[model samples]
Target: MNFANTGQMEITTLENFYRDTASLIPEGINKEIGHFNVFKIEDVLARQNKKVMPYNRRAYYKISVISGKNKAEYADKVIDIEHNALLFATPKIPYNYVPQDDDQHGFFCIFTDEFLIQSKSGVVLDDLPLFQPGGYPIFQLSAEEVDDITFIFRKMYKELSSDYAYKYDLIRNYILELIHYGQKLQPATTLYPSHTASARVSSLFIELLERQFPIESPQQKLNLRTAKDYADRLAVHVNHLNKVLKENTGKTTTDIITGRIVQEAKILLKQTDWNISEIAYSLGFEQVAHFSNFFRKQTSFAPLAFRS
Candidate 1:
């Protein structure tokens, strides 16, 4: 019920996901070639100790065909799915999947970007409209479309458990098939209005901001640190970006950017053993003192104090 903690959402790794759901990893999975797995939605739900899915970014890509009533909460929006739908989720955004009824039946497949690299599918996952930030990635499905999707998922499940040597290659083709299928249908974009240029710019700014996050290492520094930097990347004036964001989100550009940085700082402080300097540098602060000041001003707690 509390969405406030959503700001401090952590990235869910595959190991933790499997352990949390009590789902067994298939024996023949090769992590080096990139991990890929498919599961029946009911089977996964039945094995879980709790039915709740947290609001967090996954470290892998996921495509799900969900049939039933459900609610999906993203950082800036909430979508109520009343029927069968295909959902595509990328690692860049955080979302919470909440089922509203007990009659849920579907399938979901999670795979790393590496999983598709070997296939040379020529389709960059990020370039796809479905996985783009602020793009409508969920599609409402008709009964026939649902049957087509279900058939693909079932084939994936079947091939995954088989003894065939070229099964992964075949599986990759099926994944591409689903991707193409979803592309052919219209995205449920009407659910989120982007009717104006300002709205579109605001969406792009937010996407650019989100793409820099989940900093995997202390060595990975934040790229676009300021509103001006984002404006340049977006080919818009800084004033224009700020005004658009203010009109759309009721927050200035700096407010949104700093708020996100503070959120990531909090996550790093609590989740990792990284020192203050490492965390500060990663968040684009040149000095630990500056980061400390920013943290105290924003969250009213020093980084170390919050960690303790």
Candidate 2:
């Protein structure tokens, strides 16, 4: 598939995916996943993109675990997924599936924002960390934790297909429970924090910084990826964010943000076959020359030189 800027499905209706995959569900099992009908499929076919698709660009996020050997190409990273593990998939990202040797046990339940976040839970749901389209999902749950989660999903399946008035509400609660459990499972990253203004700002700033990194598309390139852009989004002055970062992390906001961007640049440069111009564009640099100048100033080497 053409991975660059394929708006093939923008926030696809979950109901339609359910209808299409209806035949995949095994017979005679009532499975409820987030207030919608749950379809359990062992064989899944989807698109896989080259390293140019946006990280947050996906219609639905997936949580999967399998024992059979599997291979995935995400950007410049090709991973051998052969053990019990959990990972995420965004709708905007292009990905494909291959089941190895037919000995695989996997479960996936698809839901839209409508199904997950209703009136009461939507506000809190917005703060959830895994839902971040661009964030990481490398949590390694303990065997007990995995079993617990599986049991919850099994119960959710039963509730989903039942004819009950409050099934939706119960599903919402179950969804919230899963999110809470995930929050506990997440690494001690700064993404999970107590409620505080500065903490909130820091979290938002980190998200904004991550969104620009591991550059994905040319048109989505970063000409204006700077502290000011983030300040505007946070509704705080640039200096204020810098001060917050300095006070919070012992570094200026520019240092932290630029450091993150540069780190990603180093990874893409050294690892990917994508050229300098492509990397620059993905990082939102309007001109490759400008990106080169900035890269040299920060790392004492031009983007191309560093890659070589």
Candidate 3:
């Protein structure tokens, strides 16, 4: 019944994650860079004691190889896996893993952005297409691809427990390998190539908008709530930003902004028990009545009605 503190409706911190699953963090982790840990899917499930994974954002990044029937729900999308798939999760988006059957097998590793810093890998976590806000993070794998990924994960598991002085470095390479492999598996069309200034601006605008998300706590308010707000952040004139967005997405700047806000509103309404006033304030509405009017206009349903 005490689900709020259990991360059912808020951001789950790494410490809470370990506690919830009855898993132990490795002793003497290198806090200078960050933390890294890998686990067998079954090992984590066995310790879960049937506790459902919370549909909330996490404070860290995660890579998971899920085998078996499962469903993944994000704030904006849902993916159902009938057999095997690779999932990449970031702290910006909240997700819930629902296993449709009792049989589950795979591996997952949790890490922080600093774990593979630019100094080590010359790779920025956000710059990766798979981890990007608009990128496709899940991939259905072939049997051969699954075997290849499993092999790398097994190497990580072994390296993590080794006495080698540079084991962490080796693990970082393994993580990057997984990332690149996923990128290669992505459909050619899904990978956006910024060939022009307008396209680049449009892409940056979308990324900036998505980075504010999952509204993990009541006190966390949205900083960019209007077209002008985003325009200012992107150092572009409001009219220019609107023109770029309209040309690229077929929706005016305000339309796109409000559309995303409405999407988040729906997720909050259905996933959390927060009162309308709290939700309104978090979404940058000064009054619940205003939020109600906006929600009704966008969704044709009152917040309470939608929740029910």
Candidate 4:
């Protein structure tokens, strides 16, 4: 369990993201009710060895039931997954799962992004608030609701494995139905601010923050890619943008900006094989020392020490 120098594992494709990870359950063993590729795993467990990351441009999502001693962190929150309960993972965000102790049983299904997009007509996946990276995932499902979702997954799985033509089309439709159901179930507002007139400004700031950092790539050092850069792109006064973000997320514009940079730094520190200099440069720093100092100020540990 001592991964002293944990190397970065990049998942740029769907197949690349899930390879060797999912196990298919045998027939007549686990009760599968969904129409999708529902895999029921009993008494099996896994802990994320490295940072759990996935690229989901293809619009994939995951639904899982974690019974027994299993937990996962979606951002900063740790969730205890219970029996018959539902947890969702959208493609845009990255998450990590760690086992608390030992035995656990669960069923999980992965469906493509197109499955959800179809039902929305002209709408995009990004339009779905729940699919956003920082949003929460755990949903307490009623028995009837759980059964309904499971049945949809089962149907999808059956059609996926069938010999009939246009089976994929049917399967995709089922998956879309599942997400539409989820969208219906989701709360109208987020725990974070969403209704302020400045909310759009905050959202744009987030998108800009995300665009500045590509996953697992070492390009530049953490060279104080400051609020000015973001302000310029937004075509707004730095003070105005800062005021908007402060009113919304309770964080200043610079704080929000640097917070994002430091987060990517932590991911790079723990998951990638890159050295300090390369990581620094990748983060837009001119020198490794500057990145180290900034990281230490934020985290109280140097990048290397934090990874260890």
Candidate 5:
């Protein structure tokens, strides 16, 4: 959870984010935001000895349009944002931003999902392609896009202090507009556009597989644990999924599925104290014996022995 130079930070509140960097917060702002707030950094270098933000999950969603140079690290990818860039941040993912020099300045807004979901628009934030974790959330904006985005953020800044009763409705519209803009540039037409059919199928298959993960409780069983199940969910034939997986990864669909299941099983065995039967049941095994045999075949060790 800790980065190399910077210690560690788990910022879940707006005040904690703004308190350390007073330059970012504008004056005359209502000192309290029940769930959301917008801040524009007129001078990014105002704070001396600025440290890099480490990868951490926060309880807020952030959309920032930065107009300078900076490097961002998200999960396993590193992105260099030159000129003006529109970046999206979500609570489900971890990310980091390292400012380049003194000239890094931009506008960023933070809000809880409740802020938008409770609005009259009834938008499902996570369901949007722009907000989805695996979808592209960062864009190198054209000058016109920058101007358009800037106008929205500026409107948000002005409306934050407005006395209008329906100002929030207008602000929500701005937020949605920003998202739609990003979506228009993002891979809304296709999640991954590869050259070969094998690559596309592989990428899509992996995405579909990942959508079913991070099993939360014993009461919740993994629904798609087989190649056929995944193929059905992805609207592809089982043979087609197997062929593409073999072509791209040099492994059959069943092999990939089994390997992933074994990895998940090992994690559960090592990280949780769930009994073998419960773990097996949650992993889509009807009986503990079947799961034990499968685990032993895959790992060359019994589940209990591996756990011990």
Candidate 6:
């Protein structure tokens, strides 16, 4: 989400999202494994708290129950939720919601891909149609459906407070059940418009970039790390690609690519025990020294030093 092409759209991380949405520090036992969180709007308001969500792509999946009149603006479509409804959001899309009236009511929860991976399914959350590109991610709820959805949220909140060892496993199943419930409502209809030339190139460039990610193992090396590689795949001159990116995101192609790699490097260093060389090569650096130098330049810390 930190690419050059993202102009006014900001990226909201889980920690900051919690602070903004609920005015909480996200402390306690789950701080280290802080990939999941839940909040009720009523609870937040009763505490006289304020919500501060801007238009952006949240770095996680958000499922919520909303009531009254509210509007959600996505990349391709604008949806108005009336009465009770369920809404789904993914990282691939940038969106924001504005309350049309003072009667907003809801429960919301956010979880990262890693949160779901810990479950038995062993699947990537982004690969699911519910969160995939050009897929439907919203549903309206009847009063009965609202009751059912609220019940699911109640189970999640209750399990999250329990001492059960397998609570997350049960929570994951409930999340899946909610997802399947939405999927069964009707097939996902593509709402995104066809891209313009510059927009198309940028979109293709992003898709090509994300394709190299998650770096499943040390044996997996990133294929597209430079501006030239992306330009070639997009069938455009490298200069043209760079110009479009700069125009769209206020950053050159190389800057955007490096930012993404460095961000990934930090994530791997923080989340996994991968050795320096493994992390280095997986990110497409030829030598550990080069990766070390790059990481230091970008983050002001040596690789192992950062890990420590």
Report lDDT per candidate: 0.83, 0.58, 0.84, 0.62, 0.73, 0.73
Residue 172 lDDT in candidate 4: 60
Error of 2 at 28 (Å): 16
Best-to-worst order by TM-score is: 3, 4, 1, 5, 2, 6
- Give the alpha carbon lDDT tens digit for every residue of 190-268 in model 4: 5234666688888888877766644544543343378988888888999998998888889898887787778778767
Per-model TM-score versus the true fold: 0.69, 0.60, 0.89, 0.76, 0.62, 0.57
Residue-by-residue lDDT tens digits, candidate 2, 247-274: 6678887788777667667766764567
- Residues 129-200 of candidate 3: C-alpha lDDT, one tens digit per residue: 787764558888889989999999999999887878778878889999988888888777656575679988
- Residue range with the least summed lDDT across 10 consecutive positions in model 6: 1-10
User: On a 0 to 100 scale, what is the lDDT of residue 284 in model 5?
Assistant: 97
Give a tens-digit lDDT track for model 6, residues 183-242.
666553332424678877876776688777656567888998889989998889999999
Tell me how candidate 5 scores on lDDT: 0.73
Could you give candidate 1's per-residue lDDT for residues 75-137 as a string of tens digits?
Answer: 445899999999999887767679998888899999888888888878889877778765568
lDDT comparison, 2 vs 5, better candidate: 5
Q: After superposition, how far is residue 116 of candidate 3 from its true place, in Å?
A: 1.3
Question: Which segments of candidate 2 are over 4 A away from where they belong?
Answer: 1-41, 45-56, 65-82, 87-102, 123-126, 133-135, 159-167, 187-200, 207-224, 229-240, 246-252, 259-283, 292-308
Query: lDDT winner among the candidates?
Result: 3
Please provide, for model 5 over 1-308, each residue's C-alpha lDDT reduced to its tens digit, 9 standing for 90 to 100.
Answer: 11122112233345556555663443333332335678766543355346565455555788999887888876445899888899988865567677776576678888767667756677777766666654557899888989999999999989987887777767778888888788788753553456687787887887777666545457768899888898998789999999988988799999888876776677567656789998899889999999999999998999999999
Task: Name the Cα RMSD for model 5.
Answer: 8.6
lDDT of 2: 0.58
Candidate 4 similarity to native, TM-score? 0.76
Task: Give model 2 RMSD, 1 decimal.
Answer: 7.1
